[model samples]
Target: LLGRFFEARAKGRASQAITRLLELGAKQARLLRQGTQVMVDPLELVPGDTVIILPGEKIPADGVIDAGATSIDQSMLTGESHAVDRGPGDEVYAGTVNQQGRLEVKVTGVGPNTALARIARLVEEAQATKAPVQGLADRISAVFVPVVIVISLGVLATWWIATGDFADSLSNAVAVLIIACPCALGLATPTAIMVGSGRGAELGVLFKGADVFERAKEIDTVVFDKTGTLTRGAMTLTGLDSEADERLFLARVASLEAGSEHPVGKAVALGAEERDIELAPVAGFQAWRGLGATGIVDGVEVAAGRARFMADRGLHIPDRYLEALETFERRGHTAFLAGWGGEVRGTLAVADTMRESAPAAVAELRRIGIETAMITGDSRQTAEVIAAQAGIATVLAEVLPEGKATELARLDAAGRSVAFVGDGINDAPALAAADLGMAVGSGTDVAKEAGDVVLMSGDPMSAVVALRLARATFRTIKENLFWAFAYNTAAIPLAALGFLDPMIAAGAMAISSLSVVTNSLRLRRFH
Candidate 1:
């Protein structure tokens, strides 16, 4: 009975963490009905309902803001430390607090469809699953139970023949059986896993399964995807030079790029918009994958992309333009050349800022004796610069999107256990190929699904936290198992030798299980 109590207590503590997260859903929602506010249960909300959120109220459901603006505190959900500004057309998740301004949010998701609910479900499922170490304990316990019974029968017979006292012999046999109950062995691995994973969730890390804890501890090399993983993934136009009228050159390039869905193209278009440069309509816009784009901009033929694209188009590149391209590349900025009417007209440089946490994350990984590498589709000079900035020594530059998985395979072949961190649809393959895949929370659904661990904080430093937590959790499991095995080994013989009374042996068995539970609960204090 005492053993069962300890198990129940451990389970209760683990569930408490998850319960607190699920409670984020507001009980009542203030909805805008016919321009008047009506209070209703959050479950009654549906898509397209306009919910009014005032200062300090929890957002009732996931939705887009229809009117008004406010600073939303998402620290509880995403673990971001600062509140973010949200205005019309921006997304506000359910359970986040609205500060200062009133927001009219059009509901897009409700009930179980909310991000908070999904996170709770994921954590619950991970806890319910068993780790490989738990399976080993179960197998050992299965073999141990019958062997202990046989030994108990042997002790009963030996004592009866020697002393010829049935009552004394029975007590000794019963004591052996009581002390070798296997309760501690059963609770050892699972309790620790439950607490560790629960603590991980609070730190903005989510393990997809109990088994991921085992796999993560074995990772020796961590490969990070460059764009969204290390850098902010937002591009800015840093420099623009032109031989023709600067505004006209930018207008032409930005107009052709406006049709592109690429990040670089979007950056160019946004630069034009920020400068209030009116874009001319383009006819026959064609995008050459990984090279450049071409179109007829305001009746003039315009080609904008890499210098290689210019060379391919039979366009003349001036010496000054070549010098500018080299300077931009040397400075770790992506440079693009623009030309029209068979002559290179201008050059543009775009750069992405590195995340503030990236360097610290690399340093932490190194401190823990793990190797770090970076993989990117950028040019060699660009990748090297970014890698150096993050203090990463190994760089796999110019790797195509399809080649990421192959690069990870090479690391695996070299006997290195690799964990890949990424946040894009293109990274899904690599995320699956690594020994352990960690997906940033802000990544695409496909990438998250393929990853074994999801970093809900979307901070590179969280990856380091995940790894350290895994090692700590696994170490606790080992400790619990050792204590359970050692306690059984030492106590069984003492009970069989008539050195312990049956009541004393039962008390010892309960203490052994309680010790394991207490040890596992220590993980709750883990940071």
Candidate 2:
């Protein structure tokens, strides 16, 4: 507001003296420090602690719903609209308003574990860590401020001594100072980062800070997990090339495996449903967990499982069917052989297929110069098959959760900054170890919390969105640095020669600072 008044006065839109006095009053109000009435140290809140939140009171810590529900307004921190309904086990963050309902929350996280504290830490880290390229602006500003101040004084003194006109010298100094305010310099980098992060949030991507964001721009390689991350994590029937009523055999298998929890059982059941086949009732259902299931379906002993299960049951599967099963498995598919009594009837081929967006996303990444890779605990065939379909350039198969971090470290040692994208417990270590760890929104809180970047949508396309945001942010930083340095460089010399005025100096400072802030907000449009 003061900046506006000064700006108005400068342009003769408003009278100068009155506006200046009002501005000074506003400044006084801002700078006047008040003593605290009481010295009560704040309490550190923890998760699962029963917390009583009162009207107009700030939440002391992060907690979950333990008993009572509450209508919380978290607009301040998360920019959410309306009061949020929080019940038992739901996470409520600190600094959120309890607009309605009395809350009795079980504190789950206390002190530094609180979301507010985490945000604070992230903000602190953001402020502390400087991107290698962003430091240039700060270096210039450090030298610029003092030099400008000294030059203004020298200019005023020189003019007064030469012309014996104190008032004219003062006017010249005011002009120099006003024109030279370092507003642009101060506005540059931070504004770009703010804009970048804000834009990312709109696209369902949240960057922890500027440094994390900058690393995204430097990544030349990316690694992916196969199941859940690439495929649907659930198998479905692809094609059925068989004889002797395939649907009838599928329905029988579905009934036999209905009580089983194996992926094959579930796949068979789902296939029957998709084909609208009436299920056969099975008596004496028994499961073999990792193997298969057996039951008396339609008064005949039926079995569906691997070839081993069929062979053990004295069933004879034709060589043609066996070859087909082998071919499917080689291409990363799980095939179940179904038979009745002692003869193989049909084959149910199931596999976790790739998402429609995966291929396009991989292509886009390659177009942008990022090399794509996949890491998975799946069999070598499965991993290679998925990688080939997604157009990934590299593949790591049969990688257990413990081995992911080691692979990321190897990539780092090879001069590549690794970004591990995953959404499961297996991803936690890799997320932590990678230069940039990104979690899909569907992942566990621990994984999301561990990641430097989290995509609100689990879409593989979100990776592309994140990368775009990183590039934009990096560009904005460069723009900001340029403007900031330019402001300081131009202002100092004028101020040193009695060519700047005090009021002008103040106005210039206000403008420069405000410009930086405005520039920072530009990232909001990125979404």
Candidate 3:
């Protein structure tokens, strides 16, 4: 009964941690039916149903906004402290709180299909899985039981032959068996893995299996994908130069790009709108495949695209504008030259911004003695610029999607245990090939499936935190194992020598298991 009580307590502690995450979902949902709001259970929500979420209310299902807009606090799911703006056609997940404004969301997923449910399932699976060290413990326990039985038999025979007393010999043999039950050995690695993995979930890190804790602690070098991992994936206007009227030049360029669907063109158009500049109507708009786009704006021919595109259109770029283009390109920005009536008038520099936590994340890794490197398909100049901004020393430039795994192999050949951090479909191979793979939460599903650890926060600093947590968890596992082995090695002989009563032996065995469990519970206090 005492043994069962300790086992139940250890299991209950792990279950409670998982329950906290599962309880984040809102119990009820407000649905819109024929223009009327109806209260319904979250589980009753189905696809195609429009749900109404007001301020200070939790979103009850994963869906797209059908009407209205609001700022949503996604800290519960993504660990981002700030509220993100959600408008028409924006995706919202269950468990996120609506900050302000009314939103009508078209429910796309609910119940087990929701993102929150998937996260809880992953945590449960990780806790249920066993670590590699547990297999060793199992083997030892298997051998230990029989060896202890033999010792107990020997004690019984020696006592009975020396004193001609069977009852006393039997009592000593039973005491030896009771004390050397190997309960502590059985509880050591698994309890630590359960508590450690549960703690990881609370920190926005999800370990795919118990074995990930072992692999993560062995990482000495961390390789990062440049785009969408260390840097924001979206392009933004960073620098603009014009020899003519700045607003007029921007209006003409933005007018020409307003018809395009390319990322750079959208950034240029958005920049003009943010400044409240009015764009003239464009006519005869033509886009060249690899070059820039040109159109007639307000009776003048305006073009916005690459330098080659400007030169192809017989436009002359002044020395000052050319120098500005070089300055922007050298700093990893993609420069667009805008020309009107055969003369280049302005230059636009667009680039992906680095994450706020990237520099500090790299510094933290270095401070902990882990080397950091960056790999990307970008040009050497562009890759180097971003690497320097993130404080990473080694840069692998112009690496194709297929070649990323090869670069990881090269690192492995150099005796480095590498962990790859990536957030795109192209990174799936590299993620799987590394010693440990960390996938950003905002990344593609394929990348997350390949990763051993998922960074739900999507912050570079979370990767550092994941590594620290893994190391701490593994350390706890080792400590538990050591104590279990030491306790058994010291206590078995005392029982065999008749120095311990059977009742005392049983109590000691139960305490040994409880101690291992209590040691693992300390991980719940980890930051």
Q: How many residue pairs clash in each candidate?
A: 0, 38, 0
Query: Please, what is the whole-model Cα lDDT of each candidate in the order they appear?
Result: 0.88, 0.66, 0.86
Give the number of the best model, judged by lDDT: 1
Report the Cα RMSD per candidate.
2.4, 12.5, 4.8
Over 4 Å off, model 2: 1-143, 174-181, 237-325, 334-349, 443-448, 495-511
Clashes of 3: 0
Descending-lDDT candidate ranking: 1, 3, 2
Model 2 C-alpha lDDT versus the unseen true structure:
0.66
Q: What is the Å distance of residue 515 in model 3 from its true position?
A: 0.6
**Where does candidate 2 have its weakest 10-residue lDDT segment?**
24-33
* Clash pairs, model 1 backbone: none
**In model 1, what lDDT does residue 463 have?**
93
- TM-score each candidate: 0.93, 0.60, 0.84
Better of 2 and 3 by lDDT: 3
lDDT comparing candidate 3 with the true structure: 0.86
User: In terms of TM-score, which candidate is stronger, 1 or 2?
Assistant: 1
